[model samples]
Target: MLPRSGDVLHVTRAASVQFLRPITFRVIRVLDWPTYDGWLWLDGYELNASGDAVSRRSIFVQREGLHQVQTAPQHRPHTVRTARRPVARTPVRVG
Candidate 1:
């Protein structure tokens, strides 16, 4: 699900995944920016359920075109599937 216009995102300090780019994850505030396709440079709000904020991160993300994956996340289980393709090809000369 996408974040609401005024929703808040909580970036816990215990987070293991490093989101180097921007994304439209749940629990994040939406802002306005001039960009095409992907999620552009927008402001992020950090807050805890107890009315306290943990940390705020600057973000820019691609909505659909780009592929997003997680490197690591504590206490969470994930399943991924990969494709197998030939790495090299050798030509044979017929006698």
Candidate 2:
């Protein structure tokens, strides 16, 4: 399942690059959603080993490096095409 915007995610250190501990994050935006080996972009405050939020904001994590806590519900966009009906033709009166 792909995570949608405004979804809170708990990223683990094992899936991180610098952080050596579990960090809670929120899904800001999704860069790509493929059938396999897809990438996920996230942004949140940096947390210390003690799970304290740091001053650093706009922390972006992408690619296979970051992992989401849970797969957010996929918000499928509504795609419905409306068909046009044929109009009746009126005969013109010529003088």
Candidate 3:
């Protein structure tokens, strides 16, 4: 699949020999540079286990070997609570 901006991928040795160690990558954009058939050059970031970007990089891999990561559904919005005001009391007159 053609990776687009914001796509998360699981890159491994299957993608390319350079990636002996697997990495979680977030795509910044797909590079348009020419490459051999079935191969592509991708511009993106290396993501940590927590899904945070650790570094920026460009990778070369086979399109058939690239795996897209499925992102979790968005969280529900929190409900707003209305606060109640305290009742006011009248002061007593002094003699």
Candidate 4:
């Protein structure tokens, strides 16, 4: 889902991935810079256990990595999925 200002997202912290945990956050702004290999920056505040504000910070995440916790069907642990980059090739000379 496309994220916008005031949208809440469920982000998986790098340190907590080993434990499969996620933290809730509210999006304050979306950066306008071009995407770098599918990663972008998002500025927002981290929500506490009671859904309260903690502190504001900028987070880097992939476009597809950010999940809409507000409209998600279900909440669960984050699963890591890796895709292989396709090899680029020019026209091959036939014998």
lDDT of each: 0.44, 0.55, 0.89, 0.74
Instruction: By TM-score, rank the candidates, best first.
Output: 3, 4, 2, 1
User: What TM value does model 4 have?
Assistant: 0.60
The sequence of per-residue lDDT tens digits that candidate 4 reaches over residues 4-47 is 77888888754233215777878888887676776767888889
Q: What is the descending lDDT order?
A: 3, 4, 2, 1
- TM-score per candidate: 0.31, 0.39, 0.72, 0.60
* Model 1 CA deviation exceeding 4 Å by range: 6-28, 46-52, 65-95
Q: Mind giving the per-residue lDDT tens digits that candidate 1 earns over 9-76?
A: 33322222345433333334445777665454435544444545466655554444323232223445
Off by over 4 Å in 3: 71-95
What overall lDDT, based on C-alpha atoms, would model 1 receive against the true structure?
Answer: 0.44
For candidate 3, write residues 1-95 as lDDT tens digits: 88888889999999999989999998888899999999989998999999888999999999989889954345579999899798898998999
Model 1: number of backbone collisions = 5
> Where is model 2 more than 4 Å wrong at Cα?
32-38, 44-95
Worst 10 residues of 2 by lDDT: 32-41
lDDT (C-alpha) at residue 61 in model 4: 76
